[model samples]
Target: MKWSMRIVMTLTISLVIAVCLSLLPKMDSSIGINSPYHWPSNRIGQVTDNNLPDLLVQVPLQMRIRKVELSSTRMSLDLSLPKNADSTSVYRDLYTIAQTMLMKTKNVNQVWVRVIDYSGVSDNASTQLVLAMVAERESGKDMDKSASELSLIQLEQELQNRFRITYTSKWQQRYPL
Candidate 1:
């Protein structure tokens, strides 16, 4: 009887250890509520010098681009902002947000970002901003160009798959709120 009890206890302990071990990896991969932010070292999206600084260009804008249209050096992006958010904040947010999105595509250049519309704003909370970005692909096939292009394609696919994956991989480790 004592041996049986010991066996049961051993099994329980083993099962508990196994369960705990299994959870470790999942916890690592699973998106945590308050995870540290991380992003690719490289930066994307260059603010055009010639273009007039509109409500855009503010660093670290809260809004993200919803759509991007490209045409040569001229490009437009539809941005989405948080509720009650300021245009300046949106503008600032655009830089990092655009970098996160455009870094995923190879044929992006001369990005033109704009606050196309405001969506879902609450008097109590900051409004969400939606933005559109339009840009062109740089031309060339040299090794550097080819590499950049490949990176762009890969980044684009990653972003298209899920902005959170790309954005979190690049910036915050936590899931976007």
Candidate 2:
């Protein structure tokens, strides 16, 4: 009888210890403690840039875009256009594309579209269109660009087209808001 009692007490103690040991890891994780033995450093964190969502590839392919560079808040696109494409039409198309593609992205608030000549030569000519998130979000009634602003973009496009001027660099970063 005495031996049986000791065996039962021993079993109880062993069961309690087993249960506690099993729960230790879970408790540590719930409280934000990482166990070095169980958690691998590389597997436990956020994905790096190389593994970012496939938006980078999908955006260019879907839009017939030539090149795309994306950061947290801004995206720059290189689009191939005919040598003498109409400035207004090009701007409209670029604005529409930028708005549609980027507005829904989680953190993107601005898009820079560069209309490059079909020749793909840096010296040929390009038109740049920059769209801001705030302006895009505003009601259509309030979203109109000033006449001068519209004319300025048009003029720049015209000058570049006429002179076959191109920027030395295809991509330029705009100041962050």
Q: Write the per-residue lDDT of candidate 1 for residues 85-156, one digit (tens) a residue.
A: 653354334434445335433444445655533444455256332343433233211113221333434544
Candidate models: Cα lDDT each: 0.43, 0.46
lDDT digits (tens) for residues 1-177 of candidate 2? 999999999999999999999999989787653422232222322222443333344322222466767676656667765544444554455544443433434445555566654444555354443321222222212323322355546644533342222332322332221
Clashing pairs in 2: none
Instruction: Give the number of colliding residue pairs in candidate 1.
Output: 49
Candidate 2 accuracy as lDDT: 0.46
